[model samples]
Target: MTVAEIKVIAKEMGVKTSNMKKVDLIRAIQRAEGNPICFDTHSRENCGQEICMWRRDCN
Candidate 1:
């Protein structure tokens, strides 16, 4: 997803994203959703979270 879209999601989640990078914003969002802050850290491209919303971009 684009930064704008991510920012929107962050906004809805009450996260301040004005100065956050893409990765940071995504991790923050995950924390807000009570998920792990594991964005872009899939070592083998095989994440265990089957229903992860960030799967498409979390390479």
Candidate 2:
């Protein structure tokens, strides 16, 4: 998602988005949701989270 879109989600979740990069923001969001902070970690090849919402955007 775009930074703007991610910022919206972050705001709703009470995550401070200032000065945060997209990957960091996403990882923070994942942490907030009690999920793995695995975005762009080069784990996609072994990441079996097919139903994850961030799958498409993951590297």
Candidate 3:
């Protein structure tokens, strides 16, 4: 994945994207995408136009 995408995911996850390791970010994203609860709580359940699950909140 690209750095920009990682950053975006990190941001959605309420993480400091600029300071996170790529490996860690990737893992968080995978977990968020894998679970509906995390995705809904942080990523997709938002009312705003931009809704992204706390990509790290799953695992």
Candidate 4:
């Protein structure tokens, strides 16, 4: 998906739309696609790192 589409969800939840990537966006979509609700609003706190899914590998 495009950054604009990701921005919509982030906008609804008040997350800043800068430096976000497709992998993270796709992951977020997958995480929320079927749940009744998604608490993950793309916050830096929620995402935790630029490479959230792979950060530990670097560490």
Instruction: Score each candidate by Cα lDDT.
Output: 0.86, 0.91, 0.53, 0.49
TM-score (C-alpha, index-matched) for candidate 2: 0.92
Q: Per-residue lDDT tens digits of candidate 1, residues 1-59?
A: 99999999999989999789998999999999988788988642555787787887887
TM-score against truth, every candidate: 0.85, 0.92, 0.38, 0.34
lDDT of 4 at 33: 52
Misplaced by over 4 Å in model 1 are 44-46
Please write out the lDDT profile of model 2 over residues 1-59, one tens digit for every residue.
89899989999999999999999999999999999889999998888888987888999
Ranking by lDDT: 2, 1, 3, 4
Candidate 4 residues 1-59, lDDT tens each?
35687668765665555676755554454455542222244354554456443233222
Extract clashing residue pairs from model 4.
none
Q: What clash pairs does model 1 have?
A: none
Clashes of each: 0, 0, 4, 0
Best by TM-score: 2
Q: Against the hidden true structure, what lDDT does model 1 obtain?
A: 0.86
Local error of candidate 4 at residue 47 (angstroms): 18
Best lDDT among the predictions, by candidate number:
2
* Candidate 3 residue 38 C-alpha distance from true site, Å: 18
Clashing pairs in 2: none
Candidate 3, 1-59: lDDT as tens digits: 56678788667877665566665666566565563323333344343424433443322
